[model samples]
Target: MRAVIQRARDAKVTVQGEVVGEIRDGFVILLGVTHDDTIEDAEYLANKIVHLRVFEDENEKMNLSLKDVGGDILSISQFTLYGDTRKGRRPNFMQAARPEQANTLYEQFNNLIKNEGINIATGEFGAMMDVTLTNVGPVTLILDSKEK
Candidate 1:
């Protein structure tokens, strides 16, 4: 499992011109699941994201976690994160999990985040989505279960 976490002042996801999910003063998470990902991976990534100290503190230093600032999360499924372009002009997604498995893990990841006692919003899994966000401090971080 992997996630690209961006601190945002606000974020929303739209599908077919209908807003599916939205949040304010939170994280815009682009989540990816791989063939090897399991519930454990989902849990780990969720925990790390919520506890990550990317928000600023009293002295303008980045020291406040999402939990500390009472923030929400907007999670979006993005299997393309696994795309490999090392071979040629085209990218391969062989490392990404099948839709069935990916969807299950994606749901699990979102549920885990919700269970963390924070508000959570999500984009439709496997759907074409348009995501909008006002990135805060332009703070972005990548989390991968394999790296931990």
Candidate 2:
């Protein structure tokens, strides 16, 4: 499992010109699943992301977690994160998990976040979504469960 986490002032996902998910003052999380990803991976990332202290404190230090700031999450399933660009003109998606497996893990991940008591909005799984966000501080981070 992997994720691209971006702090945002606001974020939303649209599908076929209809808003699917939206949030304010939180994170826009682009999540990806690989063939070997498991529930443990989803759990690890959910715990880490919600508790991550990247938001600013009263003194302007990056010391507040998402919970501290009452932030929301706009979660989106992104299979292309695993696209392999090494030896071909076209990106290879061999490392991405199959749709069924990916969607299962993706839902589990979102449930874990919701269980943490943080409000979470999500893009439709397996859909062509248009996501927009105002990235606060332009702060972005990448996390891979396998790396941890």
Candidate 3:
């Protein structure tokens, strides 16, 4: 499992011109699941994201976690994150998990966040989505379950 976590002032996902999910002062998490991903991977990434200290403190220091700032999360499934472009002009997604497995892990990840007592919004899994966000400080971080 992997996630691109971006701090945003607000974020929303739209599908077929209908808003599917939205959030304010939170994170826009683009998540990807690999063939090797399991529930443990989902849980680890979710916990890391929620506790990441990317938010600023009262003294203007980047010292506050999302939980400390009372923020929400907007999770979006993005299998393309596994696209391997090293070989040729075209990217390959062989490392990405099958839709069935990916969707299950994605749902579990969202549930993990929600179980943390924070509001969590999500884009439709496997749907074409248009995501919009006002990135706060343009703060972005990438987390991969394989790393730790």
Candidate 4:
């Protein structure tokens, strides 16, 4: 499992010109699943992301967690994060999990976050989505379960 977390002042996802999910004062999460990912991987990431202290305090120090600031999450399933482009003109998706497995883990990941009492808005899984966001602080971080 991998997550690309972006701090966003506001964000939205649209499919076929219809807004499916939206949030304000939150993180836009692009989540990916690999073949070997398990519930434990999803659990680790959900715990980390909710507790990540990247928000600023009164002294302008980054010391506030998303839970501390009452933030939401816009979660999107992104299989392309695992695209391997090492030796070919075309990116290879062999590292990405199959759709069924990916979707199962993806949903479980979202549920784990939700269990923490944070609001979650999600893009339709496997859909062609257009995402828009105002990336607050332009702060972006990538996390991989395999690396931990």
Q: Ranking by TM-score, best first?
A: 2, 4, 3, 1
Residue-level lDDT of model 2, residues 1-148, one tens digit each, is 9999999999999999999999999999999999999999999999999999999999999999999999999999999999999986999999999999999999999999999999999999999999999999989999999998
- RMSD of candidate 3 to the truth, in angstroms, is 0.6
Clashes of 2: 0
Candidate 4 lDDT, 1-148, residue by residue in tens? 9999999999999999999999999899999999999999999999999999999999999999999999999999999999999986999999999999999999999999999999999999999999999999989999998888
- The lDDT values for all models are 0.95, 0.98, 0.95, 0.97
Model 3 per-residue lDDT at 121:
94
The regions of model 4 sitting more than 4 angstroms off are: none
Clashes found in each candidate (C-alpha, N, C closer than 3 A): 0, 0, 0, 0
On the 0 to 100 scale, the lDDT of residue 53 in model 1 is 91
lDDT for residue 29 in candidate 2, whole number 0-100: 98
lDDT of 1 by residue, 40-83 (tens): 99999988998999899999999999999999999999999999
Lowest-sum lDDT 10-residue window in model 4: 82-91
Model 3, C-alpha of 11: deviation from truth (Å): 0.6
